[model samples]
Target: MPIITRFYGIIIKMYFNDHLPPHFHAIYGEYNGVFDINTLEMTEGDLPNRAVKLIREWAELHQNELMKIWEKKVFKKLDGLK
Candidate 1:
């Protein structure tokens, strides 16, 4: 997995040629979740409420860039929540 962002001790990552629905993985300590890019919903797994909220907010902010990268098939770390 390649980390695309890190903030508030949370790490966001995605794998190249990954499974469908356009999603990414969010990891916070022992907690983790797979979030759908468009819906910003947790597809599976779990994380703290605060962390999840932060992640959703961050994802919303970068949705356009994320989708662009996804379509471009480029794997690169993105700036975390700011």
Candidate 2:
């Protein structure tokens, strides 16, 4: 997994040549969730409400960039929430 961003103890990552629906992984401690880039919804796994909210906010801010990276199957560090 390649880390794309990190903030507030949350780690965001995406794997090269990953599965469909264009998604990224969010991890915090023992919690992990796979979120759809288009819908910004958790497709699998679970995370705390607060973490989920923060992730949604961050994702909203970088949705386009996320899609670009996903389509290119390239890793790029993104700016995280302050």
Candidate 3:
């Protein structure tokens, strides 16, 4: 997966050029995961103790923006807001 965004305890990524409801991949060092941008569900993978906490917080903080980026990306928006 491509590393799109990275922060203190999280890394946001999109993969395989596919989009339905919009989601992102998050990684926190020893912990990595695939999460839904809409419901904030941990669709797959595991996160470490601190990573889990940070992932939850980061996702909540950027949920809207993440979803928006996913939408714009898949839809091929010319002036996409990233």
lDDT of each: 0.89, 0.95, 0.67
Name the runs in model 3 displaced over 4 angstroms.
74-82
Sort the candidates on lDDT, descending order.
Answer: 2, 1, 3
Q: Candidate 2: TM-score?
A: 0.97
Question: Where does model 2 exceed 4 Å of error?
Answer: none
lDDT of 1 by residue, 37-60 (tens): 999999898798898999999999
| Worst lDDT 10-window in candidate 2 | 15-24
* Candidate number of the best lDDT: 2
Q: Which scores better on TM-score, 2 or 3?
A: 2
Ranking by TM-score: 2, 1, 3
What is the per-residue lDDT of model 3 for residues 32-77, given as tens digits with 9 covering 90 to 100? 7878888888778878666666676777877776666776654221
